[model samples]
Target: MPFFDHVGPEPDDYDTSPKQDVRLTQLGSASTKTSFTCGDAFGWANRTPGVPDLDSRVALDTSTDLASIPPFLWGLIASYGRHTMPAILHDVRCDASKAAAGNGGRARTAYLRRHADHQFRHTLKAHADQGVVTRYIMWCAVRLFGFRPLGVAVLAGIIVSMLHQSSNVFVSVSDLLNKVTIWPWLSWLDWVPQGIAWGLAQLATALRPNQPYTGIMIAVATISLVALVYRSFERPAAGGPVRFSLPALLSLVGAGVVGVLTAPPVLPLVVVTMVTRFVLWLLDFVMHWLDLAWTKVLRLIDGATPSNVTVPEGAMLPAAVPPFPGFFPTP
Candidate 1:
C-alpha cells in the first residue's frame, strides 16, 4: 500500500498516544477542522505501536509545502516575492483594516491613485526644467550677436544639426540592411553624398572673385535672415523654430556696420552655405536607400531557414589571425 494510504485522517491514528485536544484554527476561524493526518505522527506509531507522537512525514501543512509547487509556479512566486511582495505588503499595511473587512478592492484602487499622482508630479517637474534650459541657451546665442555674427552662427548651426540628423538616419538604414540583405556590402555608400557636398563648397569658394568684404558679409546676412524667416513661417516638424544667441545677434550687427563702412563684398559665403545644405539632403537620400536595403535583407533572412543552422560559410568562427604585423617599439 502507498505510504499515504496507511496514514489515517485523524491525528490519533498516526500518534501512538494522545494527551491534549487543542482547537486548530485557520484564517481566524475557530470552527474550521483540518482532516489530514500528520506524517511524523504515523511514523511514530509504527516505531512505537502504543505511544502517541507527531508524524515527521505529515507534520508540514500542504499550503506551506513549497516543494509540491511546479517549477514554473515556484519561479513566479519567487519573482513576486523579490519584486512585488514588498510593495503589496506596504499597501496592505496602510489599509489593513479595510482589507481585513473585505474591502481589498477599494484599498488597491486607492494605492494606484496615489502612485499615479506621484509619477505625474515628477514628470511635470522634469519637463519644465528642460524647457527652461533650452530657452536660456537659445536666448544667449541669438540675442548677443549682430547681423554678420548672427548669420555665420546660424549657418554653422544648421549644417551641424542636419549632419547629426543624417547620421542617425544612416545608422538606422545600415542596421536594416545588415538584417535583410545576404552579405550586404555597401556600408560606405552613405558617405558619398556628404563628400560631394564638401567638394562643392570648396569649389564655390575658390571660383568666387575678390570683391568688397562688406558686400559679401551683407549677402550672407541677408540669406541667413531669409532662412530664419522661412523656417519660422513654415514651422517644419523635422526642424522646429530657429533660435539665435545674443552674441550672434551682436556680431551680425557689427559685421553689417563694418561692411557698410568698408564696402567689401561677401556673396561667396552665402553660396557655400547653400551648397553645404544641399549636400546634407543628398546624404539623407543615401541613408534612406541603405535603410531600404537593410529591410529587404532582414525579410529574406527571416524567410530562408532556421537561425541556428551550421553551414561553414555562414557559421561564426574564431578569428584566423591578427591583421597587424608586429607590436610597435616603446617610445
Candidate 2:
C-alpha cells in the first residue's frame, strides 16, 4: 500500500494529525536604519594582474574563523595580539615541502642531512681516537669554556699587563716626589694608592662566585682613573711646545670627582680603573698586532714585492729617524 493512500487528502483533516489552527503574536517593534556594508569587508572587484588583492575572498579563506576575516580586519586583530599573528598563521598554513621547493629546498635539505651525518660520524671517531676519558675532558672544557677559551686567556693577560704598568708608574712617581724638596703634599698623589686598592678589590669580586657588586664597582672606578691618567700624561706634539691645557685638565678632574662621588665604593672604583686601563692597553696591543698582521698577510696573499711595499722614493721619512752618514772613501 502507498503511504499517501493511508493519509487523508488534506494534511489538516488527517485523523492521525492535530487540528490546524493559525495564530499570530506581535513582536516588539525596532526602528530600522539603512547602512552600507564596509567595502573592505567584501571581496575586491578590481586588482592589478599578478598582485594578490588582500580584500579578495580567497585571501580571507583561512582554516580558522578568527583568521577568515577581511585582510585589514585580520591585520588589526593580529596587531592587537602582537604582530606574531602573521607568523603563527603562516606556520599553521605551512607545508614544509612546498616552502622548501620555493627556495631549492630539496638540495638544501639533502646537503644539511649529509653534513649532519658526517659530523656525527666524525664526532664518534674523534671520541674513539681520544679514548673515553680524554673525550670526556675535552667535552667538559668545551661545555665549561666554549670554543674560544683564548678570549678569556687574553683578558687575563690584559689584566696582568695593566696591573704591572700602573704599579711601575705609581712607584716611579713616588720615588721622583721623594727626591724633590718642594711641593711634596699633592692631592693627585693619593690617586695611585686609591686606584690600586680599588683594582685589587674588583679583581677579587670578579673571581668570587657570589660577589657581583665587586665587578660593578671595578667598572665604574676604571673609567674615572683612565680620565685622570690621560690628563696627567697628555703632551703636545713636537713643534707645539708642551703646555698643560687648563680646559682639558679641568674636564678630567671634574669627571674623576663626579665618578668617585657617585661610585659604589672605594674598592670597586680602584678595581674598575685598573681593569679599564688593562683593557685599553690590551686593545691597543691587539690593534697594533692586527695592523701588522693585516699588512703582512695582505702582502703575502696579494703577492706584493718588498720593493713595491717600500716608502715612495720621493717621500721623506719622519724627522724622528736618525740621518745616515755620507760616503767618505778618499785617495
Clashes of each: 58, 10
Question: What lDDT does the true structure give each of the candidates?
Answer: 0.32, 0.32
Per-residue C-alpha lDDT of model 2 across residues 200-233, encoded as one tens digit per residue? 5455444444345445446545754453334333
lDDT of the structure predicted as candidate 1: 0.32
Kindly list the per-residue Cα lDDT of model 1 for residues 105-214, writing each as its tens digit: 43332232232222222222332222433223222222222122443545444443333434444333433333332123544443443444455444334334334333
Off by over 4 Å in 2: 1-267, 306-308, 313-331
Candidate 2, after superposition: displacement of residue 110 in Å? 85
TM-score of 1: 0.19
Report the error of model 2 at residue 73, Å: 60
Point to the candidate with the largest lDDT. 1
Candidate 1, residue 178: how far the Cα is off, in Å:
18
Please list all clashing residue pairs in model 2, or write none if there are none.
198-270, 198-271, 199-270, 199-271, 217-268, 218-272, 221-269, 221-273, 222-272, 222-273
